[model samples]
Target: MDFKLSEEQQMLQDTAARLVRDAYGFEQRESYRRTKLGYGADFWAQLGELGLTGVPLPEAYGGFGGSGVDSMLVMTELGRGLCLEPYLQSVVYAGGLLAQLGDDAQKDRLLPAVASAQLQLAVAFEEPQSHYHLNDVQTRAEAVNGGWRLSGRKVAVIGGHSAGLVLVSARVSGGERDEDGIGLFLVDPQQAGVRRRVYPTVDGFKGCELFLDGAFVDAGSVLGEPGKAFAALRYQQGRAIAAQCAEAVGAMEATCDLTLDYLKTRKQFGVAIGSFQVLQHRMVDMRSELDQATSMAMLAACAADQPDSDERSRTLAAAKFIVTRAGRYIAEQSIQLHGGIGLTDEYAGSHYAKHLVMISHQFGDDDHHLQAYSRLMEVC
Candidate 1:
């Protein structure tokens, strides 16, 4: 397969990169970090106006009708710039799920708003003790007069506090943690008995913990077939992981860029530090690591569009595994090369380091992906 980007894709990358560098620089991010929202509403609206919030969605849904690869490009740039917006959680994760599983009525009512960024959505799937297992949901949804009532707690629901709606996954039949009995419901955040507590993350975004006493929704709110939402969730999860890997690749690239600039400026023994053979070798190694991570991210993005689930999982796990390891190494080397000042908040090097660390642990970390890859390999 051709790895080169088309003209359109290149333009998308350039637009996102420029927007991050010019409109929402590090200073803006710092200000946002101090805010209660942990992100600026204006910044998100600007991204929506630029069509970034809808790139990978369908044109019918108010999107630009781009592909997964295009979405990955935008995500990478966001990572490189250390953006505070939850574009991935709202657009790629929740929007993709709605598009794939929502019925015509559900899609017509919800997806257009999501694509236009008028209504932000988040997936409330993770439980307190589920670890990374998608099927291990204790949240329960039971049949009612005309709909379902959700009752349970969801921990670490990214962007849930600010979300207009939530795509909730719960056990509809059989026991909790059953793979075939899972269901998804579209719930309004303003509904009765719903409570959220928000917390800031190291990367400047916000996540939430939800306590649902009895959240109710119409039966039509069901996204797909009853007891079969796991397939859709898995598909969305793969896409999310792919986007995150792309982001990690972007952070790795930024780390290399920052380190190179540092090496050229700082002097030692009346000469530029970059002239030293030791630092030069380190720069060379960083370049190699970044290149490998980028290649793996590209491969994973391609695989996310494949029809086979098993193939997608294996490819994404491999990408996540490679990118996280490389990202961790690059982040460490960047700080080490820059010395003590690198840890200061004013330094660009520190931002890259923090973002890289966050990305390395998101979705699934190195160990999680390694185990997944090992399991897939055994079955294959």
Candidate 2:
């Protein structure tokens, strides 16, 4: 496959990079993080104005209907900026799920708003005990006269605190860990019987814990069939993982750049440390890891848009595993090379290091994906 980006893709990447560079300086990012929303509302609006928010949605909803590679271009810029926006949750993951599984009416109502950034969405799929297993849903949904009544707790719902709508996974029939009987429900955060406790994540983003006690949603609020959303959930997660890998690659790139610059300037015994062979070798190793991660991210992005299959699943698992490991290694090496300054909050390299470390814990860690790849290999 050709690795060269098309003209349009290059332009898209440039646009995203410019926007991020201008609006997301390190000081500006810290100010945004202090806000109640945990990010700059204006920057999000800028994304919509630039049409970046709609890159992956359908054309009918005012989106560009771009592919996963298109998303990778935008996400890399966001990652390089260490942006705190919820593009991965709202646009790529939740929007993809809505487009894939929502009924016509649901799409007509939500997709356009989402594409325009007039509405933000969050997905709540993890429970306290699920441990990265998408099929392990304990939240229960009982069919009611006009809708479904849901009761359970969802943990670490990124962007859920501010989202207008949250898509929750609930078990409609089978056991907690069963693959079947899973349903995705659209929930209003402000409605009765729902409670949200918001907190700032270590990575400088905000997320919430959702407690549902008989939360009610009308029949129309369910996405796809009630007891059959596991496949779509898993598929969309694969796409998110691909985007996340791209983001990690971007962070790794930034970290590597910062470390290289530091090595060339920081002096030890009257000469630049970069002139030392040992330090030069370490910098070279960091660059090598970044290159490997970039290749795997490209593979993951390509696989994300393909038709779902064992091959797709296996590829994504491997890509995520490799990217996570590479990100951690880069983060540690950058910090070690930067010395005490690398751990300072005021330094951009330190923030990039934190972002890289946090990326590993997001969807699944290295071990989780490694086990998943192993399972797929056995099946193959």
Best by TM-score: 2
Please provide, for model 2 over 183-240, each residue's C-alpha lDDT reduced to its tens digit, 9 standing for 90 to 100: 9999999999999999998878999999999999999999999999999999999999
Question: What are the clash counts of all predictions, listed in order?
Answer: 0, 0
Could you estimate the TM-score for every candidate? 0.96, 0.99
Q: Write the per-residue lDDT of candidate 1 for residues 159-221, one digit (tens) a residue.
A: 887899888898998776789999998888888978888897775678998888888889898
Report the C-alpha displacement of residue 360, candidate 2, in angstroms.
Answer: 0.3
Please give me the total number of clashing residue pairs in predicted model 2. Answer: 0
What TM-score does model 2 achieve against the real structure? 0.99
The per-residue C-alpha lDDT of model 1 at residue 375 equals: 94
Q: What is the C-alpha RMSD, rounded to one decimal, of candidate 1? A: 1.4
